[model samples]
Target: MDRARKDMIVKEILYWKDNRMLPEHYCDYLLALYTEGNRPKDKARKAKGFYFLNIILLLLIPLSLLFIYFTELSFILQMGLLIFFTITGVSLAIYFTNKGIAPQLPLAVSALILLLISVEMASHFFPHHNTALYGALMLNCLLWIAAAWKFRQHYFGISGLVGLIIIVISIFI
Candidate 1:
């Protein structure tokens, strides 16, 4: 085919991919075939950036835990740091989900951060109240289920259900 015809076909395929009119894999295969295996440079770079950001976000989970447990920071400062982490994780999750990119990394990171902060806050504020800690856990599971429903992510739903089951088992035991 001519250069102009190939370009038009590529643009149409991209439009279908972006609009979800065609399955992503099909669009990708067509693009590759038409482009002779050379994909867009910018898209590859953008994907790499997202993957790097996701890795950084994942690393923050462990760092946050260490900061909370090992630091001499005041309660207020710890809480501030937790809040900042939660906000960043949640914002990235929402952005990835909306952009039809790989959202699971950010979603998992956000869920973990929220779980940590909720448990920490509950235990700190209600040291003698086991019920409060359990409540915090239950609430987080519910939020995970809600997020799954909203984001159409089955893994979150499965994880939420498993969490609820574990909590119930522990409560009864």
Candidate 2:
């Protein structure tokens, strides 16, 4: 096909896509075929390993839950696992996000949950140190804020801000 004609067809296909006039897969195929040589290579194509890691991390969620629910593990062991998973999830989130994937949201969320679990565990272990407990809470909030700043993800930043506010309120009360 002539370049001009191909460009026109590509535009028409994109119009159809925007209007949902054609099936998504068909539109995608046409777009890829027509724009293959013209478009720059997508940045996402470079991070194949990050994509694979994300998939593995997702698959582990159910298994992790099963281990927590079905096993008669001791409290210390469970806390240890939660801490390990939290660190893993947060690290993966930071790593993948720097490489250009937005799919790390779940990992970030899992890390946030693990931080909460860690806080709960700490409270149980050292019941008398209110100052230390608040400090730990602030540290978790800072981690969220740091991740949010690094990834440019507003949700994490907002949540961290809210958490900080709550901590302040708790201290005053």
Candidate 3:
């Protein structure tokens, strides 16, 4: 196309991006193609990070199904597996963030769930230590808040805020 048409297309893509009609990454790719000068930002890093993440996800799906079906495992064993998964997920999420890829939401969510599960297990195992349980939960919430602030993760911030509110309300009651 001619210069004017190409410019018009670029403007349209920008409009879509600003209005959230198109994904920001998609818009960036189109813009790069049209402009034929500037490169798309973090393209290689995102691609590599997501490629490995997708492979891991594909493998995890069936493994997770099997895990869910296996209810006969001992509680300690289950908790151990969950802790491993949580650590792995958090590490991958950190790697993605450091590499400028969008950190995988599922991984973060899984890590949070596993953490809560492990805490619940600990509370059960130490039945006489309600105060310790509360302390641990509160510490987890505060750490989430600090991490959210440091990483600018709105979901973490929101979850941490809700958890803090719940902890405070529980203390009053």
Candidate 4:
């Protein structure tokens, strides 16, 4: 084949790999056959950076929990920190999902952070209202179920259903 044709094929294969239009192994094999084993170097570097960023984002989950439980910061400051962490987690999740990377960890972390934020804010604002707290929990569970449907994740749905059951039991007993 001509050089132009080969280059076009390689670019197409790269696009397939990046967007997950084809399985990664298939894309790799095609790229290797087309490029004669000279794959792009920058992809490896970018992958390393993404891996590092993923680790940092994962670490932020635990750090946010610690900040919420251990610190004595003012309520506004705590809320600000939580919002920042939640936004970062959610943004990373969306980016990873679009790039065909493993997005489950970031998505799960964001959901957990959101749950914490909702519960904490509800309890803080309605310290004496058990009904309000239950409402907040129920709302979070519904959000999880909605997210599960949107994302096609069974675990999220199961967890939300279980949460609803538990909340109902608590309310009765």
Name the candidate that leads on TM-score: 4
Q: Residue 56 of model 4: what lDDT?
A: 89
lDDT top scorer: 1
State the lDDT of candidate 1 residue by residue for 65-126, as single tens digits.
Answer: 98799999988788889888888988987788767687788878888988998998998999
Model 4: per-residue Cα lDDT at residue 114: 88
**Residue 118 lDDT (model 4):** 87
lDDT tens digits by residue: candidate 2, 1-173: 89899889888987787567998789888888998846554356556766677776775566556546688888777667766776777777766655456745555657555665756666878888888788888888888789788767787788889999999999999
Summarize candidate 4's per-residue lDDT along 54-151 as a digit string, tens digits: 89888987888888899899888888998898899889888987776877778788888888898899889999999988999999899989989998
What TM-score, over all chains together, does every model reach? 0.75, 0.53, 0.55, 0.76
Candidates' C-alpha lDDT: 0.89, 0.73, 0.70, 0.88
lDDT of 2 at 82: 69
| Order of the predicted models by TM-score, top scorer first | 4, 1, 3, 2
The digit string of per-residue lDDT tens for model 3 on 1-173 reads: 89899979988997787567988899888998998956346457647867877577545544544554567777677667666666666777776666466775645555465546647666768878877777778777877777678877777778878988998899889
Poorest 10 consecutive residues of model 2 by lDDT?
Answer: 37-46
Residue-level lDDT for 66 in candidate 1: 83
Off by over 4 Å in 2: 1-72, 91-100
Clashes of each: 0, 0, 0, 0
Which of 2 and 3 is the better model by lDDT? Answer: 2
